[model samples]
Target: MTTLLCDADGTLFPSEEPAYAASAEVTNRFLAELGAERPFAPEELQAMTNGKNFRAAAQELARGYGRDLAGADLDAWVGQEKDVVTAHLRTVLRPDAAVRDPLRTLAGRFGLAAVTSSASSRLAACLEVTDLADLFDAARRFSAEDSLPVPTSKPDPAVYAFAGRELGVTPDEAVAVEDSINGALSAVAAGFPTIGTVQFVPGDDREARAEALREAGAAVVVSSWAEVVELLT
Candidate 1:
């Protein structure tokens, strides 16, 4: 592959669980405002919307209640969610050599870009905390929320397509590393040979997660970044 489209949240770092912890607060607030009957616990929300952005998750939740979210209201909540999650992640995330070391090695052989459904600020904090920011240029860090003409979230291939055009690479020329079913679906939809990694998934869930990702069109599912390194390098 000529390029590597890396997913940031659960793929590049173990930010999902903690990020969700913070997001639940904001999400609960939104749910209350929407007049939804109940608040979702952090894990419940993660299970419901692991690979999607706040906007997408909000729409899905609202739909279940027959509540159509106004565009402006959704947009505002999305921003609020990002701010809260980013702040929480920055405080909780720490550098991990397991993640940084392999990507550092892989960087020599491939063009790298972070392509995610996260807002730009959230992606930036992830890269920064993991000491991975230097590996990709700001121009190479593509966010569905910040980079698209029409903002969207994974399970939607728009961001991946946008990255391909800007980077001048076809799916045949690049591979994607994603940790969520929706994320794998996004890359596969864009025609990339996707590698679904479950390194960040909880230990008890890894095997089941692998199976789910495989069903989502991943060429293979790996347990760690080292396996990813061995396959591509």
Candidate 2:
């Protein structure tokens, strides 16, 4: 059985817009309070935040404005951004309808598991909001924050490798679905045949991003969940 170990953000759910919106809002507000320059462009913001955690993103945002924020300043900014996003998570995060049917179809054909970098509570909210909680059960769902011992970030294969173990499958018997370059690297490096989704990337840059993902070790690049299902099926 090819266990489907999927990412929640950008894979099962629509997370890019909300994430970017919150990042932009937080960045601009922080800059204004400090009387710094204006926010970075969307592409710059994407490059900074797409693959990094909140602290990294905050630090990058500060660096973009010609400021260096570290230590307590950086951590406080990251915390503020996270708090803002968490406050609006339920309103902003949504599931792609295109993924739901495909997931339902694939569930019977293959083992399904959700491997996410999201905090467990946020993941639960996202799943519940999308009515997808039932699709992945407790045992099948793996959150990086599920346990303190588990590393809580990607581009480190620990989470993907752990998911394969919990699913009782080897990398060759599974597939990893991802939308970001770092996520693809994590899965592919862990020995899963990774599929890159370009749905979250801007349409103009998708080809470039697809090429990047290909270089990052995706077996294929797809534009939507439909293509993902077609490839998996």
**Judged by lDDT, which candidate is best?**
1
Task: Score each candidate by Cα lDDT.
Answer: 0.92, 0.76
- Give a tens-digit lDDT track for model 1, residues 71-169: 887888998999999999999899888988999888989999999999998999888988899998999998988899988999999999999999999
Residue 129, candidate 1: alpha-carbon lDDT = 83
Q: Which stretches of candidate 2 lie over 4 Å from their true place?
A: 27-38, 41-43, 55-79, 145-151
Flag clash pairs in model 2: none
Clashes of each: 0, 0
Across 58-116, the per-residue lDDT of candidate 2 in tens digits comes to 55556766788876776577567766766676887666677788789898788888887
Worst 10 residues of 1 by lDDT: 64-73
- Residue 47 lDDT, candidate 1, scale 0-100: 94
As a whole number from 0 to 100, the lDDT of residue 61 in candidate 2 is 55
Q: What TM-score, over all chains together, does every model reach?
A: 0.97, 0.81
RMSD of each: 0.9, 3.3
